[model samples]
Target: MSDDNGLPGAQTRRALLAGAGAVGAAVVLAACGGDEDPAGPGSAAPTAPDGSGEPGAADVVVRAADVPVGGGVILASKGVVVTQPTAGVFKGFSPICTHQRCPVSAVDGGTINCTCHNSRFSIEDGSVRSGPATQPLPAKEIVVDGDRISLA
Candidate 1:
């Protein structure tokens, strides 16, 4: 007994429902597709287009004096890490970890630590300091003009 589009046997109601479900699932997955950076401006950080938290070309990342001499600050909204490895030297790197592209959560003990899988990178050059991540965080160009740190 063939069904409407008839081939061999009649389609069961359950089978029809399952086929419909599969199509729905495919549509849902397609809607979610992308390799877009999850840390882009608003993951765990606040964002604004009115020149607030979001990093703009002219936005000051942080006051130079605000970052510690041997530590760094994670600017999640800016998607960058500003590190003062030495008193007068500053470095900037993408906040995203090389391990799984998770954002690094802290800068401590001369390392940028990603809480995702405990991967650490150098605060000095963004080099990998530990494993699970063989690559280093990519350098992010930043300008430190006197007392302000901004993306370059």
Candidate 2:
């Protein structure tokens, strides 16, 4: 028998309904089988071998000789700042200021100064040396493997 559209009637309707049901079931099943905890709270966040979140630390390194004596800071990309408070001693911190998370531009004498709000932090220990910033800048671990300086 045919419906008003001049095609199969009940059979076509049944087939169409069955196909839609199957499709719906498949979609539901697929949704249930999603990625299992790609990054859980307990799981260790993926990081470079040096323990830094930045990748390719093994290849990227700064030499102590390049850094100026007394104290000098280099602002690396990705909010990284490498500082040498004294010759042969290097420290790393996030270039972002603790006051308002502004990028620290220069290291004068032994102070890492933030142009934003003039917040100043000691290059020696990343401690807050001036007002507008109560908390110290977050320090990044530094690994001195031979002459190469890698972030940890």
TM-score of each model, in listed order = 0.62, 0.58
Cα lDDT, all candidates = 0.86, 0.76
Best by TM-score: 1
Candidate 1 TM-score versus the reference = 0.62
Model 2 clash tally, residue pairs: 0
Instruction: Tell me how far the alpha carbon of residue 80 in candidate 1 is from the true structure, in angstroms, after superposition.
Output: 0.5
Candidate 1, position 135, lDDT? 98
| Span of 10 residues, lowest total lDDT, candidate 1 | 48-57
**lDDT tens per residue, model 2, 84-104:** 877678888888888887788
